[model samples]
Target chain A: MFLNMKTAVAAIALSAMAGSAFARDLVINFDDLNPGPKKGFDDAVALFQKENPDINVIVNINDREAHKTAIRNFLTAEAPDVTSWYPGNRMAPFVDAGLFQPVDDVWEENGFNDDLAAIKPTMSRDGKIWGVPYSYYQWGIYYRKDIFDLLELEEPQTWDELLAACGKMKENGVTPFTIGTKFLWTAAGVFDYLNLRTNGYDVHNALTAGEIKYTDPRIRATFSNWETLINECGFVDNHASMSWQDAIAPFANGDAAMYVMGNFSVDGYKNAGLTEEQIDFMPFPTIDASIPGAEEAPADAFFIPTNAKNVEDAKKFLAFVARPDVQTQWNKTIGQLPINSKADISDDKFIQEGFALLNGASGLAQFFDRDAPAEMAKAGMEGFQEFMLDPSKVDAILERLDTVQAEVYK
Target chain B: MTHAAVPDTTASARPSWVKRNKLAIAPWIFLIPALIFFAIYVVIPIFQSLWLSLYEWNGLYSADGESTATWVGFQNYAKLWDDPNFWTSLRNNLAWLILFMLAVPLGLFIALFLNQTVPGMRFYKSMFFFPFVISQVVVGLIFGWFYNPDFGVVGTLWKAVFCEETTNILGNVTFTCSRPAPDILSSPEWATYGIIAAGLWPQIAYCMILYLTGLNNVAADQIEAARLDGAKGWKMLWYVVVPQLKPATFIAIVVTVIGALRSFDMIAIMTQGGPFGSTNVLSHYMYEVAISEYGERYGYGSSVATVLFGIMLIFISYFLWQMYQDEKGGR
Candidate 1:
């Protein structure tokens, strides 16, 4: 009797597997569970399913942090048809491991070569494009427009004017900047802007790429500028204990006037009860003026795993996501910039300002963490946080970073 | 042929060798299932981790079904010797071990205090046990908010005592303090202690309950005799009650040591080994190096795990030896 039941169960399972195999399924693993990002992704997937009626789409959405660790397992174990991931050095390890399949043909056929030209260099490794970027957003200083207006301060174009404004704000009992270095990456945002402004994009790239030492004179110059900012235009007190969202409290309450942050924080600002009229965005002030500015804009992309079962459907989905209309709709809902140049942007003030800033940049960096190798980025960001907490430890922090860089790059 | 059949029937009727050894074989039959599972899950992974520690792997596999791990012999271990973060994690672990011992005595005192059969004693005991009932993650989060310098209890109290709330230029209410409240979780010197305090809250409750159960088994006649002989307070409790509570104390110390070694969740929830990795214990550091978003160094993490396992093995063997000696003495 047990053997008969077991045979019956095996037959049922086999038929169920056969049923799924014949249906032509496409599996997509997305990493954002936030309301805006999730809604945007769901809407895009829904539209794709509608357009490709024959193919059944199975979507799995995971928390961003959970997805980071899960991708390492799923990409190799049970490869998804398409998966959300970052571009640049963040994708290097998977690319090197032969886990991510190159999608240059998708880009070529979809005309993303010209439309997504800005992110082409970052997405390419070993002279082949590895993924398709759907959306990216700019990183800069988001400040309190009302506070700036009340203090009679214009957007500071240079470092000296920024310090002067900071002094005025401090005199008026307002902190010049607010940041939470608890997670360690917020410090990197500040560091990237400083280094980019101090020595320009090439030096920033060289430093992250391990070609230049952290104790090099040029890098030291950036640290010195950071020290000046620490001494003159101090960040909010006890920032080391707060997350980026927590730091928004001081900004919303007018305890602090400026935040060196990304465009995506607009949602957080709104959630914290700040209106559009109250908050504003500006590019980081120039430090040397000799070196041209390069803005930080990290892109989120999708790749087909090497072992993906539904490669055809995955490529179609990638091309579909890259289309101007799809990207426009997706980024608009998510409050980010579409990678397709032809995609129309919303009338959002921050989006307009970010668009102009990126348009005028000498180059676009993928942020410190995304640009540097993971180990190097981790060590470097920790060093940045240590330096931020205690400016006097600049030499020691830099030396430690030099040691980590040596080990990481080797 | 009839005589041979008769002799065979007589032999079959008698008990066989299998029946004779059934007493010895029954326990082995029952134990085999659990023994197989233990070998597969526990015994195998410990050795696998030890083997993986000698390689330099990023925890990735190639397109083909082959591991991409490269053998680097003792390079990962050699790297740990030079790494400052490893040293910090070791120091924090040592601190956890030393500080966590306080729970035993504190728990004993609380157990003694609550041992009396007074009215509403059960209510008090249950209340004392509340921390243990609540999850460690919740404790970490509660303490994290409590120590916050901006909107937490510390921040609010600091503002009340040292500062006045005033409207800023933008008509937003903000505080101007003589000095800022201490940021405990952000400060390297204080963050570990803050987490340890959170850890101790639940741990003390656990040890208290262990002692409470032990206290119930104490002989009333012996206590009365000790009281008649003027053996009271600390001396009576130390001389009479403690000697009898040795079993409970052993288990408490064992659990506490194991707890100290596995202090990962509190640190993960509270600091993530940050304000620059100052609060990392060995387990959390291992997780950080192997599993975190920026960490894929499986070999390095395994090496650290192996070192942690070695420490745990020593403690476990010592505990086993003590238990063996105790059994011998009892016999």
Candidate 2:
């Protein structure tokens, strides 16, 4: 009689468990190393778990470096229902191979199409939406306000005025520009800005895509301007030997004055124990006021695999994450602007400035690594480093880049 | 007729087969596990790496949407031949090899000094041998920080003494006669040499311990005998104590050569082949191309790896031959 009673209770418990597991399985893989993003990810996972008590949610988190190497493997085997990937050409080859699921109808159905007009270009290719953008930050100059004040220089609005300000900073015993090119991509930040200002967005895109050659007269002018920066206004000392963090040592010491970096570095500066008032942010000075197109746009997006078992769930999650409230919460935790227009943001000073700059962008091009194919971007950046070290090698470097482009594209 | 049932084992009837071949056959049984381990770890991977060298891959991605790699044949090898970076890496390897040999004699001299039995000599021996027992990674990092020009101890010393305007090395500078101390790790021309010097720190320590052990076993009675016939100083040391150090010198050379070739970690830590690929040795360069980042030229990277393997094989074969000659002579 006692055994029979125990069996009845066990059966009831088992059935209850089965009924609860009937909820959808949502698997998410995220790549974020910073503290803010990690918290945002954990908070979102908690909320998501609470909302769907029956669903079994699994989160796979990985380091950013490991994620870059693992992304290719994950796409084919043991693929997460949804994963994070970069935008532009980094997405192109994978998209072409049918490795990604199309989220277009979701865009139209979930109101993302009408609401996210600014980011649709990042998510769109050939009229089909491949991914959903979560968050993005503007790239620009982060300078030392104290040094500028000491030199009696106001923020420069024109190119010539910026150079004159730099000249004054140099005379007062401060490095006009400070960056670590030991890893080489920091130099590309300078180059990309110059290219955007010199040739506008379409031509910059064309150059990276191999449709235009580096030796073209337009590229030559960009190099000429770059050479002028290196020659006339010297950059930080020993830039070749330093990583980005190592370069910050000089900046924190007030030995160097300016760094052109993404908003991601704001937290790093704060962690370095600098007062917020000491540092200031500004956009790259415009080259031609009349030359138009996306002044700056580099975004991070999420996409679904073409071979996924849970496409419906994946699209639903993408749509769910795209909601204005979700965007607002995630971006607030991550210190970046949300892609959604309706998200209510804290009237934080930095976000307000970033939003104004973003909304006013004449054009938006993906970051160089995203805008160009992986192979071309890598070779081009290596050339950028070599060009900076010795401007005389510009012709050779351009020729080599062209050769790499021909081979890589083929 | 008794051996007919088990010819290999002596047919079991004539007093047990184990009695006849126990010396020879027992050894094979004893060595089986070790041979299996060798086959599993060391022997098979060599042939596998050789085979892998023929293909191109990102070391990620598989065919079924699982980061699959595509196979490209001689394209990797062909590209390796065309790459300027490959050539630069090879040249740097050769440079490392040539310079790293200096540690052997330096180690010998230090070992000779520490071989004495004065008061607290054991403590001195341990102190001298300290660098070798610690990890190579730590050694590399210490040297890296030590070479920092701004706050590095060596730099500070150099600046205080050599850069003093009152005592300039080359007195021709205008106003400030002091020239700055060299940025050893930063300059491409000297960066590989800097890493080699760092590598030598542990290697010298290693060689010193080996020589100390060899010296302890040297035939002292023979040295006393040689002294009876007027052998002294340079002659006594050269014709007598030097020859007895053959075993230690053999190990010292083998390890030093192998250490010079296996320079991946130190290079990775100290200088990542920067300043536009100036200090790249073949090993690090191959890794950078084959695996790091989204580097997709697996085939070309493999070709460089194969070429490095071939060079190492030549050195390994020669070193083994030398060891074989010594063993046969000693026997």
Q: Highest TM-score: give the candidate number.
A: 1
> Which window of ten consecutive residues has the lowest lDDT sum in model 1 chain B?
B59-68
User: Cα lDDT for residue A390, model 1?
Assistant: 92
Residue-wise lDDT of candidate 2 within A167-187, one digit each (tens)? 887676566788888787888
Candidate 1 scores an iRMS of 1.1
DockQ of each: 0.68, 0.26
In candidate 1, stretches whose alpha carbon ends up further than 4 angstroms from where it belongs are A1-24, A49-56, B1-14
TM for candidate 2 is 0.88
- Top model by lDDT, which number? 1
Off by over 4 Å in 2: A1-22, A51-54, A92-98, A121-128, A293-297, B1-30, B60-71, B154-181
Residues B1-331 of candidate 1 have per-residue lDDT tens digits of 9988987997878768888789999999999999999999999998999999999889988776578899999999999999999999999999999999989999999999998889999999999999999999999999999998878898889999998989987887888889879999999999999999999999999999999999989888998999999999899999999998999999999999999999998999999999899999999999999988888999999999999999999999999999999999999
